[model samples]
Target: MNGSIKWINGSATLSPIKFIAKIDNRLYDLNHFDRDDFNEEVLELDNLELALNLSVSLYTPISFLELSNIAKIVDDNNLDYKKVDIFALRDIRTDKNFNTILNINNFPESIRKYLTLKTLPLKSIELITTFSKSLQDFLNGFFISNISISYQKAKIFIDNIAIQKEALEGVKYIDGFEFADRKTSTHIEIDNALIAINSKIFPMSISTDDNFESGKLKISFYVDKVNSYDKFIDILNSNDKDIRTLIEFLKGHDLGL
Candidate 1:
């Protein structure tokens, strides 16, 4: 089908084109084009306020040649078309080559002057970092409600004796013990919990390396005395072997078990 743009409100459709000549203002939707139909002909929007209901896919096939020609048209006409909504471009995937085309094309001096463009479903993380550093700055300053923490995994050799001391001194109550810095695939375990506990009161006798290197980090926690630490270990052993799980498990056992 030939691409067409229209405005809709609730169940009503507004006039397809609305122009205010005095202010050089024109309003119309620009999202009716399919990828196969996107060409220089679409750039004829010189003196109009445009609204687009489409996603980002419309800009995928746009070539540099078309962009240059459009830029020239906007420059020669001295168009006063402000506020262009190209929100249709958001549907395009970030990994596609079209993204590079869009960024390079839209920044021409002439095209930028007459058009205030809005893109939909903004770019992804890697794309922002790769395409525009300014975008990264803007995103970093923007506040987000949810935050994710990626853990690093590494083979951590712990001096069981030292851990006992750190646990006894660094932590207030010692109901359970966990090693957050340890690797997941390693089959290491605290063979003697009671010996580790007794050694906590004495001087540091065990020597071991604490450095670990991996993409995931461990976060073991001590559970309450009422809860069985052995059972917690068993549960963790049965799962993905992440230290965070143990910490979370202990956190859930708040009854001082």
Candidate 2:
């Protein structure tokens, strides 16, 4: 039998090619392939398409800057096509901000400048007390309104949180807060009152024990920052006596104190 042909539909025509080709002047049969042959080659392409669709569903659209980068890469590499379909090119551009985590150590200066100049809500606080004064200044320049202080280690975490609160005192620009405790064996109820009182000082949540074990407290606060669902900021700025009273009341009731 003749070799099997596969047709690829292009812009205005259908291009057909033999599924299998002869090599080294030897005749090769294409149609006699087994299931393993299809699995080794054809299945991978189908899986790749599935994966791409999944990614498209998971991430948002790309930024204009990223698109420019793609164009530059295409040109620099001397890609086969001079132009690509806008939608196809867009699909190739993964959203960089999607699930992005802006930590004290990893916050990008370019992003901060762009957001700050535009007065955008794309920036957040990464409250790390261990940073140098220069780094702290650099982060504070972003005009972020919310900060997340991670309480990872048992010993120094709370102390760091106190330091962050003191440092950010009367700083009106940053208004939101979040904290994480990585110690699983500890019960949140035991220290929930302390955390709630602290939360009053800044818009914050104490993610400890349960949250840490479930992996819900990811380092990525991008979504939290941009969405502005942080009521904790207001809570933090509230009167300390009022917050303490509320915590005491909650503790008396045996609720999430």
Candidate 3:
């Protein structure tokens, strides 16, 4: 609600493609049927089977070649940037069978920086794929913010949704906490083991022939860089203690769907 740019929570249309990603509470209900639907349901439930996920969904989709070109352009313009990836369960309370797809000892510094005590399990996803938004206009705002997902390494994400819901219920409007009850669809790009191109968000709906996987994760804080980029930077630089606490609490509440 308060940021540099306006925040658009859910939508069926975006620049990259014409699909939707919706977040809601339906108890693993499927918008469709089959493996993809099951996967999406699990993702909506917080990537239970997968265990963990961390991704950045830009407004537009960017190809790997484009990323290379941008990196070159940034270099040509003398900008600072870092690319990294990590392999581990970054943030979860328990350990079921979650394991990193790669060896952490060989991870890039950019990815290793996130390694902390709480991130013992190895299962993460990262990428620099394009967003539906034009690269020139990325500063405007994000359809969705960068997100990280994890719970119990060995535990299924769906099993804990109720716990998160109960926690949210107990804290709603308490000490400045609240909940939203609306369904929305959004487009996003993720670079986990698999890459999702022209992916859309929607409520649990009819299944499609394409093997696409998506979820409805509760997201907060829409960063608006277009209108007040400086203000956004100031907010980040300020690092208000309350903001940090709020973020932690939001993560704790987990994905409401």
Candidate 4:
């Protein structure tokens, strides 16, 4: 009950455009939720359809300054409408094992009665309902007293090969032909540490936070279809890791790292 959830993936899609001003990254224990203090913004617009896919990895408690800085950065950016989709990978840590307790099976008596006429497996008994209502119900059922959101870090991958190629062509010093049909990758390093390892083969923008210094890691993939939570869960629950652990795990299995 007092450990991290490892990772949590979520997405929000809107028909009429909506804008976000702040994120409530607080963690609450059983029976205690700071709903009044939570700050979130949503607006109905007639311009565009927007969808946001997010994955978070936590390491430590996120401070108010950090969240404010993030909000400032977003507000300052001049974002325009385009048909591009963003795929991102994140690493997050929590102060407690909130996700483990977010299972319907934890309420076996209620679930059994809810599905008395059906013989579906426990794993298939998903509760994809309204976010607020579902969360409130879960908290009430589990007797959660308090929750605190810790450190959160994410890396976003933008798939814009056409735009990249076009930009490359405008560079007079560089020969566009050299990049023609050739896969390119960008590597990001900080203080001699490889933070992001990008590959044209997989074609994603990969990033991590300070937690990379530790052995814990997370990688994510993006799919085009809607309601891809199941796919994300499948991948998250399957074989995935940071570069170092991944190599070590593979090597231990008699496979080349």
Best by TM-score: 1
Better of 1 and 2 by lDDT: 2
**Model 4, TM vs. native:** 0.15
**Backbone clash pairs in model 1 (N, Cα, C under 3 Å; residues 3+ apart or in different chains), count:** 23
Please provide TM-scores, in order, for all candidate models, with all chains considered together. Answer: 0.20, 0.18, 0.14, 0.15
Question: For each candidate, what is the lDDT?
Answer: 0.30, 0.35, 0.26, 0.28
Poorly placed runs, candidate 2 (over 4 Å): 1-60, 80-82, 87-140, 143-257
Model 2 C-alpha lDDT versus the unseen true structure: 0.35
- After superposition, the stretches of candidate 4 with alpha carbons farther than 4 Å from their true spots are 1-207, 220-227, 236-257
Clashes of each: 23, 7, 35, 26
In Å, residue 10's CA in model 2 sits off its true spot by 31
Candidate 1 per-residue lDDT over residues 1-257, each given as its tens digit? 22223222112222233221212243232443222322322233434333231221233443333332333333344532122222123233222433342353344332222112212122321133252333322222221211121111100111322334334332322223344654332223321322343254222122222322222223344566765677556654544343344334334433121
- By lDDT, rank the candidates, best first: 2, 1, 4, 3
Clashes of 2: 7
Residue range 1-257, candidate 4, lDDT tens digits: 12112121122122232223122332221111112333433422222212111211121222222222222222333222121112111111221211211333233333223322223321222321112333324322322221121111000001122224344332332212232333322112221223333342133323444434443334556666763657656544442454455446434533222
> For model 2, how does the per-residue alpha-carbon lDDT over 62-174 read when each residue is reduced to its tens digit?
33333333344334435322233332543332233221211212334443333223322222222333445444443454334322322122123324444565554453333
